[model samples]
Target: MEGLVKKLNRRNFIRVSAIAGGGFVLGFNFLSSCSPEQRPGQLIDLNAFVKIDTNGEITIMNPNPEVGQGVKTALPILVAEELDVDWKDIRVEQAGLDTNKYTRQVAGGSGSVRESWESFRKVGATARQMLINAAAMGWAVSADTCHTENGMVVHKKSGKKAKYGELVERAATLDVPQEVNLKSNAAFKLIGKRIANVDNQAIVTGQFKYGIDTKREGMLYATIIRPPAFGQLLESLDDTAARKSPGVKQVLKFENKIAVLGQSTWEVLQGAKMVKAEWKDDGILESTTDYSKNLKSVLLNEPKEESRRKDGNVLEAFSSAAKVVELDFEAPFLAHNTMEPMNFFAHVKKDSAELYGPIQTPERTRTRIAELLGIPEEKIAIMMTRMGGGFGRRLMSDFVEEAATVSKLAGNIPVNVIWSRESDMSGGFYRPMYSYKYKAAVDNDNKLIAWHHHSVGVGSSAASGDSFPAGAVANFQVDTEEYKSPVSTAPWRAPTHNFIGFSEQSFIDEIAHKIGKDPVAFRLEMLEQAKNNPIGKVNYNPDRFATVIKKAAEVAEWGKKKAGNVFQGFAAHFSFETYVAEVAELEKQADGKLKLKKIYCVADCGTVVNLSGAETQLEGGIIDGIGHAMYAELTLTKGKPDQTNFNTYRMIRMREVPEVEVHFIQNNEKPTGLGEPGLPPAGPALANAVFAASGVRLKTQPFIKSGLFA
Candidate 1:
């Protein structure tokens, strides 16, 4: 029976619990599409996601990692609103990975809010309906006469009211409500309202605990010495000196690296520095400082290429064009540099294991640790901690694997692995460096007729032309050439959009300048064409895209002069089912350096769950984008990362961040991604603004800050 319960399809998974004193606890499988029989404590399952205690307090579980994206607060607001419960009456709790009960717990690609919207609403509404039914049963009245408000059920004419705590017992007896009514958009109170983050007070007071703060009784700290470069392995290690270091407990050598365990983190750090290891190159990759040259070589002579998208006749359109604009753009690899670095705690035993850490993909973490420790997935328990930052870095469980391996090798005692700042930065899994070639054709009348884009990288897609300006042009072609590398890479923030948005929008701005039109007007013209006579199946809504573009321009007062030598640049993009437009304002200093003055962002993500949180995400993304464009890059030599710490890898200083204003389009469209959509356009807008202020066409990334205004 337990095995069957664990194997039940997502839809068939349901859990119910009775409170000690009075109320009922219900765990709604938001991902479940089918209804199953309600089982209360007969089979094993996870604790409930939604619980009503005997005191009428509501506890809602947020399945996704907070990762500083505010899903912790935003998702619970979603449930509380639909449940018709007062927001203040609900306490949000972080849920651990439980594949049998909670699927889709991973947080990446700005999908946490977008994916959980419908199901969480259902979870809340279903619980509310159950409470209403329970009240209706207890009052001996038709359920139709009962409605829920402020955590209580009211009988309209009978003048009888019952708290949720008093009605839970009856609710438990009733069958689970298969269908429940959802609140109308106009009725949403807690969702759209600006509510403070649940952890804001804790965060401000330095009482909030992150993965770095995790500790256990008798836990040993382990520090690893990995290869300085990729394609290298440890040939020999002399850890005898390390074991003799102060507070050093043990020194273990592995196939690829060495680990030093000590009584304290300080001891582990000192002991790790004392260990000596020699690495032998595998000869898989050679040392190189020029990524741009390598990327261009791949694009020029790649034997195989894929045309991601093609429409009309690109060659013929270019041949008949009165003018052609062509350019090349490249962006370097980027490190995640999460605030807390990568750390995890594990206690692996022969039959079972316990793990805790800050990770975005928790279920995958459990599965991978199980495979590594040779334990049943069910026997391995994973506890999630607050992450200082994710930005897609925590999506990988390599840190967890290291901790589990250390624990297993050390007699299955609890081990906490902590990566130093240098180690975390040098560790691979960076944002892949990418390069692109863009060609645009315009007639004598300045009407765009053709577009061609070729991108080269390990993760580059040939179909980038399919993003924006796809259906807007009659002739569009995108070709992709891939280059394999020994270095590891993964999605960073908006992934491809992070670089694609800058290249595409910057080229569009160049075309608009040559055609003697305002940048904003040029995009609006293309959006108009896409709306009226699109060349192909346009995946985006033309109206929404155009709306945000126009709104951003209006708010920024495009073409209007501000105080001092300020210039404005405009760009817009659509990604993750959301539309965003940004206008960046720049001021030139007396010394010919550029200073960001302000940024205006307008978004159409559809029915924002938390307005304040949404705005903060946009603001953060804009600054992050600016920081990367101005000073962030990861170079490689011999398949190894060059940047090792914040000293070398630049971050946006507090003073460097500019004032930002955010506005959202109001509609009932389902909420889309907020984390990434705002990021893609920021780079282009800032680049365009740099051109406006400095009269330099910045084609490369990290913008060569010193030469920008030379």
Candidate 2:
């Protein structure tokens, strides 16, 4: 049946397509845990696609969009390692969106490398084997007697060597090996090495083309005027002045928005400023004070929905506990604030549409555009551009949709929609504000017996029942409630783990201090219990989690008394299938001000690909985590953001950044996620260190508001 074939094809499949220039093209599916069955008319998955040309040039297509996460460099190294090709001879290219040719092409979730690790290795190994077979046949020798090194196949006994280019013609004719041998861990030459990012030179040289840099022939620049507040809807629009502005071509109104099209970005922006628009409140004009009060009330009351996770009787354990430690934490909504403002280029014709932009979800955006234009899905094409910064902002395609709508409404001419800094800031889809109430029950012996968590947020809950402290406690329960709001919300960085890690780990530290136990030892004891006698389903590897915690503590010299008002704080978390632990060291100045001196991070994301890239990711995540936790906050006043630009919105300065040292646990396991795991623990560690130094328990986010640093 067609359904059966589709289900089986989702597991794994490989296809070799003909090359236009008479060479080889190998496409390997990402999910290879099971054997792939041949199915008619079914397009299977391919995450790693490679091409070998006649001139000995090898090209690897990076399926995932590059949003400065270093997949542009780290992913190709996976293929190059197993393909046995010289790194200098390989070319890396950004792949276009093609559902048939690639799967999981979108960039989000920190899953690009994690999903492609095994399949990409198989891709390179399969191609290498095909070339070996061709060489062995040409030499009249057994395939087992041939080996590949540096893009050449050699007949071991005869010492006959042939470059990959020389054998590509014959290799293309050979049947693909059903099972290919992957190189051992020791065989890797390019994976673990420190390799610079593929686009580093281009970025530093100002040659990189981001989405905002997109330009096309005869393309008109446009700016849109949207409602100033969340609950407001456009009631009236007067664009007569905008139409008469210099270089202004047309001013069109579509769906509560006024678009001013002109020859230049400046002209369009100036024209947009001339447009008059009136808005009316469509619903409740929610403010930060209202959100905070409502969320806190939800946390205090019983959730309307069923409990997310319930284990042994938490009520009974709490009733019989010797002491109950309870704490409530609050976090404000956060904007993505990508360096480059939102921009997209679109041209919708009668039957086809062309889109180019920095989008994390390209295929989804393309499909949406097709539906919006009433065109067939096959007629829409999208080209993904390197983003200045995504941080989960590009996952939404509002800007892309606006571009297509503007183009279609403007005589189907090419149009590029650009948003100013204020427009980008006011545009919704921010990280939802969250409030968490954590309770831990301890017995007379100071043993943690029960854990209960209640979370309330604007849109959805950011708590994972399977994360740490779940299986560690004998009785555990998690309850969550979502509050309806007019403001849009989307994932920011680690998403659920960002706030959960901070609140949960900080509570754990509080409990440890209450029981008079060292933080690191207390966590180790909990992990040991989870490993040996877990209460329920343990989704994380307890040993791996404990390893990073211990490593971080050791590296930071945890619990050792430091001279001159210095204190260290430790926190560990498991997120995105990666284990990360961070230690923050803070010192109090003579003036009684706290200074973040340094941060030590230990991560176990399995085999490191591109050591330089991994370190950069870890360090960047740490800095971002510390910066947001310390100074970033977004508030709403009458449903409009109080801070529209950097002038009012605060960010951590470079001078305030502490020295960060990253230590990666070396191992041979399959690589996991690295982009987000390093972030979750950074905030909690720094907050705990601040508490240790100032003897003040800060429960809210944007630590600057606490005035501890001052």
Candidate 2 Cα errors over 4 Å, as ranges: 1-20, 30-46
Clashes of 1: 1
Report the Cα lDDT for candidate 2.
0.87
Name every residue pair that clashes in candidate 1: 287-638
**What would the per-residue lDDT of candidate 1 be over residues 1-710, giving only the tens digit for each residue?**
01011122335436566667666666655334432222331111122367887678889987777899998898888778877888888898888877766765777877777766666776677788888998887778998888888989999898898888887777877887655677878877798889999999999999988877778898999988989997788888888888899999989876587889988889999999988888888876544445577778866753366577889998999999999999888888889988898999999988999989899888878888877777899999888888898888898988899999999998889999999999999974888888888899999999999998888875445235459999999999888776676677887898788889999999999999888988999999999999999987698999999999989988988987787888988889998889999999888888888778889999999988988899999999998888898889888777777789998898888988889999999998878888878888988998999888877778877875557532
Alpha carbon lDDT of residue 557, candidate 2?
85
**Count of backbone collisions in candidate 2:** 0
TM-score of each: 0.94, 0.96
Predicted candidate 2 versus true structure: per-residue lDDT over 1-710, tens digit per residue: 01011112323655554577668888855444542342342223337888998779999988788998999888889889889999999999998888877775778888788767766777788788889999999989999989999999998788899999989989988776767777777768898999988888888999888878878898999998888999789888888898899999999999878899999999999999898888999978989999999899888788788888898999999999999999999999999999998999999999999999889899888889888999998999988888888999999989999999999999999999999989898875899999999999999999999999999889877688888988999999998888888899999999888889899999999999899999899999999999999988898999999999999988888888887889888889998889999999998888988889999999999999889999999999999999999999999998999988999888889999999999999998878888888899989999899888887877899998887795
